[model samples]
Target: MFNKWQAQRWWSENYDRIKELYNVQRLNRNAFALPTPPISEDEASS
Candidate 1:
């Protein structure tokens, strides 16, 4: 259920909305916003 151009266009437009939703915003910020809160328990444990 995926088209190459359509997918590419999505990536080009939304960039990584899917990845962002999954919290995988590493290389792209066009669609994803970086996580600011601590992700590890070490900080909480401190």
Candidate 2:
């Protein structure tokens, strides 16, 4: 199929860039969902 071949060609040409972008997006998503560190003992004691 023409669409399939075109997709394949595009992927071959741009796979590395696509992968890099996907990785960056995934890292950003994970960073947003992650929690902050807990306060230290001195701060809690005060």
Candidate 3:
């Protein structure tokens, strides 16, 4: 049988770990950052 309270309790218990994992993954993706695109000639003259 499905229990909503049980699901909520499990999620609450694991929320911190889930958030930490997500942050680590995001940081890893950002660490090897992409270079910005080159500016247009008109913009450079302004």
TM-score of each: 0.33, 0.43, 0.42
Q: Which of the two candidates, 2 or 3, achieves a greater lDDT against the reference?
A: 3
TM-score of 2: 0.43
Measured by TM-score, how close is model 3 to the native structure? 0.42
lDDT of 1 by residue, 6-43 (tens): 88887888856777788874665555775688668877
Against the true structure, candidate 1 has what lDDT?
A: 0.74
Q: Positional deviation of 46 in candidate 2, in angstroms? A: 60
Deviation in Å, model 2, residue 17 alpha carbon: 0.1
Candidate 2 per-residue lDDT, tens place, 1-46, comes to 5598899999899988988987844355566686878999999999
Candidate 1 segments exceeding 4 Å error = 27-46
Worst 10 residues of 2 by lDDT: 24-33
C-alpha RMSD between model 3 and the true structure: 6.0
What is the per-residue lDDT of model 3 for residues 1-46, given as tens digits with 9 covering 90 to 100?
5499998998899988998978744357676898899999999999
What are the runs in model 3 whose C-alpha is more than 4 Å off? Answer: 24-46
Please give me the total number of clashing residue pairs in predicted model 2.
Answer: 0
- Check candidate 2 and list the clashing pairs: none
Residue 2 in model 2: lDDT: 56
